[model samples]
Target chain A: MISQLGDGFLALAQPLSFLHLVGGFLLGLVFGAIPGLTATLAIALLLPFTFGMDVADALIMVAGIYMAGIYSGSITGITLNIPGAPSGAITTLDGHALMKRGEGTQALGMSALSSAIGGLVGVVILVALAQPISALALQFQTPDKFSLVLLAVVTVTIVASGPLIKAVVAMALGLMISTVGIDPMVPVGRFDFGSYHLVEGISLLPAVIGLFAVCELIAQSSIPASLGKAVAVATIDRPRRRDFLPSREKIREVGLFTFLKSAIIGVLIGMLPGGGASMASFIAYAEAKRGSRHPEAFGQGSYEGLAASESANNAMCGGAVIPLLTMGIPGDAVTAIIFGVLLIHGLVPGPALLGENFHVIAPMFAALFMASIFIFLSMMAFGPVYLRLSQINRGFLYAFIAMISMVGVYASSYSLFQMWMALAIGVLAFLLRTFGYPVVPTLMGIILGPYLEEFLRRSLIVSEGDPTIFLRSPASLVLLGLTLLFVWLLRIRPAVKRGRAEAAS
Target chain B: MTRLLRGQVVFALGLAALNTVYASQLLQMDRPFANGEPGPAFLPLILCGFMYVASIIIVVGEFRTAAAARESAPQSDVISRIALIGPALTISATALFIVTFFYFGYLVSAAVFTFIVSLFFNYEKSGDLKRSSLIALITAFTVTLFGWLFFVKLFGLYLPVWEL
Candidate 1:
């Protein structure tokens, strides 16, 4: 596996491919530094770029972008009050407060060191545990797979931010779209709607780009100027006397302690359906604060908070990749896209993981390691300089994003229709964002919907249409039972109590 | 209703309408399976049913909110009705853009199609010609670069490209 990964890296070492790594890192930095420009948006835009490239190069670029993108959010979080990414929201607990106290550079420095260490540690876990995780995945049967996907889809109904009805509608809409292409078991088209293009159903790249990125742009345009202004970053004239070594020593002490703690947190969260960097970072931040000697200093701007978030979030990189590489389950949105890439590359993640394809794991691990180091060195050399983009005008800003969206959509297969699709969806997404419909759940449903349906359908097929297939498989039964238990605890029981209490009142 | 509620209502309604349309599509579906088992349209109808019920619940909930609010303040209801128009126009314009995709071509069609879009939101500053056009040109160029360089040249799938 290690040699395979080395080969993957060596393949990427060419001037062109190596430049792609740098380009991707730089792209992540810019996107992460921007308050609303997210890794999701970046990857969506870059999807078109992949329409013409090798799947390996495309996957490598996006993966690098994703890893560094999660890490780079702290740069803005520490220097500016804004979190460049969702995962970095916790970093603002202490990062911005510390920046106000003239430790902006110091915080950024700690963020860099901790981010690198945390990412490296996470990669180590990925290397060691991926094989074991892959082995566990082999135990899954068709019934298990189907039931698991159901549990995943149903899990959203309980935890979605909006009303359960809205969540259900969104999920149902996604499932309907999933059936547009040729049916897996059957030969003829279902919802192709008479168009040859429809025979392929809705393309994942264009559909996702439209739903998330385009919609965001529309919402952004509608926002009042007050909401548009990004958080201000105080200038650092003295630059904290350049004390990174001291900070590193301090972080090393903390990193040594939280390394294991963060890895455990990341793994636990990564195994969940919606568990991604955001949740992992949040959990790690809470744990770090819980264990810190200076808990009072946390929200006010503690270095430990920064360390915890950067490390845990980056460590989440490995955790998120585990299911993707081994079991074909996507750990998060970004990995969901990676699942798309793996499928495009003709790698069926399940049985393929146990075979000679052990080669894919090593290269992915190595790429992640390289991407992390690149983020570290890149941030040290160039992160501080780009802290001033908040001042850019709205028209130009959205225009730039629109341009990327256009070029990216068109590039994704040289298709004008895809561009229109992006613009169409961007407009809708923009509206949705304005309306406060959480986009994440919908995206999650879209990405996971098909797999879940296939799983459920296949399980029924295997069981001769017995719905009890879910009950018969130990794994399926456990997953479904746990899901039901969670729903009862989180929603049904809580609602019941609320109803009783309200009646009494 | 706040802008949030209006959006939820519209999306819910739109999804309900989509379910009706998709269910129709499913009924018309060609059955290709040999086993005489449930075919492509089977689960799709189930899915549409799910969409319908979910949308109904959402609309009912939002409508209840709208009805309750009407007794307190009619002005908010009027404001919401007015605000919903902008999005309706925006979505209609998007459908128009998609419909005319081949005629407009990727670059020209998107620019003209969405120029009013950018203008509708950002055209108040008449004095800033350079910035606005620069933004427009950049937007157009983005269409070209992403379409040509990234998707067509690199990833190389047959997307819906437009040319002479």
Candidate 2:
């Protein structure tokens, strides 16, 4: 492991790998610090670019983007009242308050410091835990794998931010879409509907582009571009580079224990299916407030609250990658795109990935570690510029996204049909969002549907059509039980409680 | 029912209809249910059942919560009504740009696509054609040139310019 770590650093030290890291980090910062843009979009746009690069470099660049993007979400939250990303919303409760109190510099500094610590801890945990988890997962049978994928599908659907029925419908729709093209098991066409292009099935590139980039474009078009006016620049004073460094006294006040605890919380949340940075940060912030001596200071410029959220959200980057690399389960949309990257590079993300391709994967782990440290360096060096990120021209920005998204789709597949497919999915997604259906589950369903189907059919075939095969295997039984447990906890329990309360009232 | 719930009801019904078509198609496949062996249609058939059930639940839920949903419907209705000028126009513009792209090539296609998008967003913001068009033109040129260099010159990826 030590030698691998050393070799990882050596690989990252190459001139091209180093350049991609810096480029990806800067790209992530820009995207994360923009209100309507996200790290997912950044990576989605970068997908085509990665097609021509080495797998190690591609993974390394994605690593830099993931770390920097998750961390930079707080940059705009501290300087402006608006969070640049969903995960940064929790941080804004205290961060914006600190800005109003003339402690913006200190808040920004602490955010960077806590993110670095949390990120480092998360990476260490990821490295220590990923291989062990992969080894255990390798022991899984077809039924067990099917049950596991079922758990992921259900968890992702139920955790989506809408009605349970709507999420289910979205997942079903995605599964139906995945059913298009040729059938995986039978080598027969299923849902092509007489179209030649549909026979190939919808690829990940268009689905991702349409779901994120094009959906964003249509959504952004609804708002009058003038609406997202930044806070008055004159009110906030620019700080010197020295001011961007968290003072030792301030660090002592936040306490190292708070940082470590929040990071652990983040890592654990990230490991769970449907766990995301926003949820991690929110839960960690709440926990920090509960544990703080000055709970009242939370949401009113408490550095501890800011630290908790920033640390946890950044740490989630590493935690999210763990499941993706070890078990082929993507914890969130960003990791979903990373799954595509792995597939594009001829690397399948599952138990065998680590044992067979540890050399290629090591550089990404190292990049995450280095990018975490770079977060502090960037915060100190370019604190002022981060504040002005939202002020970028909207017309130019969306136009660039529009061009790159469609062009990227075409370039990757060399098929015009895929580009149209992207637009079609975008329109469908926009309609779904308008009707209150969450789009993430649809993307998840599309990505996981094949695996879910293959495992189930294989298990059924092995058992000679007995449904009890799923329950008979110990591992499969445990996974199925966990799925039920999640449904009871997250869905059934809430509905039952609500029903009882309504009756009593 | 509220406009939102009404829309959802229609959507749910539509989805159910689509699922029926999918199920019918599945039945057309060879050995869809060959005894004991799960064929191509097995998983899809299961998914179709789930889709139909979920769609029904959605429709039923909308009816059950119609009163509560009505109170919140007006706010969203205003936004969606405004979307005619906002998203509708932009989507139409994008569709037009794409249709023109194949015949016109990358330079003209990209420039026009960027120009229309930029103009719409800018005009929506400032409501000044002169400024919007100026920004649109510059944005169009820069974005088009960048796409050309990056995809064509740098990465050497193929993007059809002009079939005509």
Q: In candidate 1, what are the lDDT values of residues A1-505, reduced to their tens digit?
A: 6667678778677776677677777787777767777777777767655655566677668767887788877766666677888878887778788778876766777777767777777777777777787777688888787776776677655566656666665666666667777877767787666878678767777777777666766555444444444556566653323443336556664657875677568666766766777778889989988998888877887777777877788888877787677777675667777766666667776645636566554545666788878766765676457456455555555555554565555555556566665665556555445544555566666667667767666766676667887788888788788888867976799889999999999
Off by over 4 Å in 1: A230-233, A238-255, A414-436, A485-505, B1-7, B29-36, B63-164
lDDT tens digits, residue span B31-52, model 1: 4233545456667867777777
lDDT of each: 0.67, 0.87
Give the best candidate by lDDT: 2
Point out where model 2 deviates above 4 Å: A230-234, A496-505, B30-33, B70-81
The DockQ assigned to candidate 1 is: 0.28
Candidate 1 at B141: error in angstroms?
A: 6.3
Candidate 2 scores an fnat of 0.69
**Per-chain TM-score, chain A, candidate 1:** 0.90
Residue A233 displacement in candidate 1 (angstroms): 5.9
